[model samples]
Target: MKSSTIRTFTTVHTWTGLLAGFALFIAFYAGAITMFHDPIDTWALPKQELADARVMDKAGAMMADIVAKHPAARESIGVTYAAGHPSHEVAAYWMEKNGTWMTQAIDDAGAHDAEDHEHGLADFVYELHYDLGIPEIGIYLMGIVSVIYGVALLTGVLIHLPNLVRELFALRPGHNLKRLWQDAHNVIGILSLPFHIIFAVTGALLCLTLVALMAFNVAIFDGKLMSAFERMTSALPDTAAMTAAGPGADAKTNVPMLPPAELGAIARKAALGAGATNFDPDYMRYVHYGQPGAAAEVRGTSEKTLGEYGMVALDASTGRIINMQLTGARDANHATYSAIFGLHFGTFGSLSLRWLYFILGLAGAFLFYSGNLLYIETRRKRRNAEQPMKVRAMATATVGVCIGTCLAISVTFIANHLAPYFGAEPTLVVQPVCFITFFAAVAWTFWRRPAKAAVDLLWATAVASVLVGVLDMALHGDRLVRTLAEGRYDVLGVDLVAMAMGVGFGWLAVATRRRAVEGDPCSVWAARSPRVTATTTPAHDG
Candidate 1:
């Protein structure tokens, strides 16, 4: 490549990476945790189990209670089952008069509002991965960021491809800090190029689908884009037949309804027989539950398929399958649509695939981290000269947002464990606790030097991670032992991962402190002037 072309690509890579780096950092880190979302939910929430003999009885009762108290729910009620260490109990949910949602959990004691614990942590983390926790616009913003990331990825590969063969594995360990960092960054980026590409494409397409539809509506379809798309995607052959009265409307009839378990069984048989390799009925949605025209929709996850979830709609009164959208029945467009989610979330495979994604996701987070560090290192001034203001700001943000996010998440875990003792709802405390800790850490970074703040926040994250894991295990030691003996690894895995994170963060904190103390005096990371030498000898920390 020509020198001028190299410079152009480098500029594009730098600017694009800088623009999207922090958001991608949060996304990657949170996404890594979300890879084990079910396990985390199992670890965090109280487990409830009903005997096989009584499970159907409890579900039926729960469904009946929901319809009796909230007649509006009879129009469209969903019964979500409690499958294998469910984060929550078997419950029914529907929209209320004010448009808010209401839920009723199964109560063994026959009491109202038995929904005690809320496993919102996993969901919140997953939201952070996609939206940075912003409501309406955040996802769109990340979509734009993802587009920029793709450009960065392209230019980055362009810059490195020329030297790929000779320097791919040439990770020189000594003195020249920039070369070492670049070497590591290049290796990871090159080796994981495919992973990053999947994210860049899927993230953009998923988040911007609505935006694209709107654009196409105005530009090409003459306002028929959404209608056309809906017509194509509708599961029901006759969409009008599936329509029902809005919330707060009364049911057309007061006839008896079939048991939930029976409907679930019918739906399950329909889905599996339609070519789903594995189906576990998780949710059943009923329209006009007690009416002659009542219908049911059952949705569940399927194993070892690109389309991870399959659904069957039934005529509830007769247990007759009305429509099936299982893997074998899906058309090309629908299969592709479903596969997007499965590919992005690794839901098409077993536990081993999830573990692989988790590791790669964390490495993706480190890629952005290292990108920020490279920016700071490249812009450093001479040994005796003052560092640039932009360099300082980037360093501060890199430490504050990246490290602070980790600290906040760890602290939120601790808060979740302790919320019940204080008579607080765990779900209610999640957002406030997370944002407060995050902003405080950011404020601390601004108050202190970046070098010192990085060490402080990392150490804090380490301690909190360790405390949440070890202390929780201590409180539930007997249960842990029993579960271990019983071959249940969900809770044990979460606790162990937490402790491992602590160890990782602790090591980072010590390494960063060491780099700060002994690095070049003019380097932004250097805490103070070195007594041993005046010569510039930069040190790096990753």
Candidate 2:
């Protein structure tokens, strides 16, 4: 490439990265934690009682009771089976006309209210990953950010192509801080290039689905794309469409319905016959329950497949398989969509793959962090004078949004542990607690100098993380011992991980404090005055 071309690419890379770095940092950091979503939920929430032999009967009763109380819910309602995980409560879900869902556990003592489904720690962390804790517009905003991130990735590769081989592993951490940061950023970015690209592509596609659908409808489908698209993705016949024309569609019937266990067994057999190696049905949605036209859609996860999830639809009244779309039997379009989710979430492989993804996610977060550091270092004032306003602003933002996010999430974990003691539901307070801690930490970051705030927040995060482990032990010691005796490790893993993160944060705090106080007198990270003696050595440029 020409010198001007390289410069153009470099500028593009820099601007795009700066534009998307903070959001990507939050996404990656939270996303890493979400890799262990089930385990984390298990660790933070109280366990549900083990299901009895009559659990299937209870599920069936719950479904019937829901439709009995609210006839309108006969249109569509879903019930999730526990599948041996107490955290996976057997719950019923129905959407209200106003576009909100109501959930009720099968074990509830009385009639359930129209309360919205309560999200656990894993789901909330995932919201931070994709939505940045914002609802409605956040996903779309992140879609645009993902586009810019893709551009940054391309331009970055272009700008570094010439020197990539030579500087790929260069890590000179001497007097040239800029050189050190640059080398570290390059190393991580290059190593995680594929992972970043996968996220960029899939994230944009997932988040911008509506936009793409609109564009495609106008451009190629002549405005008839949605129906076809829906059919392609969901092989099952639309219940609303069926209800309009099928037998007994206009009225409810008094016919006895098949047992929930039998429906699940039929779905499981269908999935296995359709080539899923192993299928565990966890969710089933009923449409027109107790009627001749009733249908049930059972969805489950499959092991050892590109499509980690598969669905089997059945006639609810007679237990006849109406449609089957398992991992191996899916059509091209449905398989493609399922594969996207599997690849994006590392759900197609073993637990080890999830762990690998977790490590990569944390590394990706660090990659963006180091990119910001490189930007600040590259712009640092060299003459032992006050730093530029833009430089300071970037430093403040880097500390606030990045490190503050860490502290906020750690505090959120603490809040999760503490909520039960006050007789509050953790699910109800998780969102409020996360948002509050996040905004407060950001305000604190802006209130103090960037370097000082970074160290302070790091320590806070360390303390908060340690407290998560401490509280888990202090509050649930007896339960933890009992669980361990039974060979359950999820809760133990979470506690250990929390304490480990605390140690990491503590080390970072000490290191940051040392650098702010003693590393460089003229840098933005320095706590001392910018003035230097005449005989001071000049900083080296890489």
Task: Report the Cα lDDT for candidate 1.
Answer: 0.80
Q: Total clashes, candidate 2?
A: 0
List candidate 1 segments past 4 Å from native. Answer: 47-75, 96-104, 109-119, 217-234, 242-251, 254-256, 288-292, 529-542
Expressed as tens digits, the lDDT of each residue in 217-295 for candidate 2 is 9999998888777667765687567676456555556546676777989989877787678889888888777766678
* Predicted candidate 1 versus true structure: per-residue lDDT over 65-125, tens digit per residue: 7788888887778877665555645777788777777776664565356333343877788
CA lDDT of each candidate? Answer: 0.80, 0.83
Model 1, position 530, has a per-residue lDDT of 47
Residue 297 of model 1, lDDT score = 79
Local distance difference test, candidate 2:
0.83
| TM-scores vs. true structure, each candidate | 0.89, 0.94
Top lDDT model: 2
Worst 10-residue lDDT window, candidate 2: 533-542
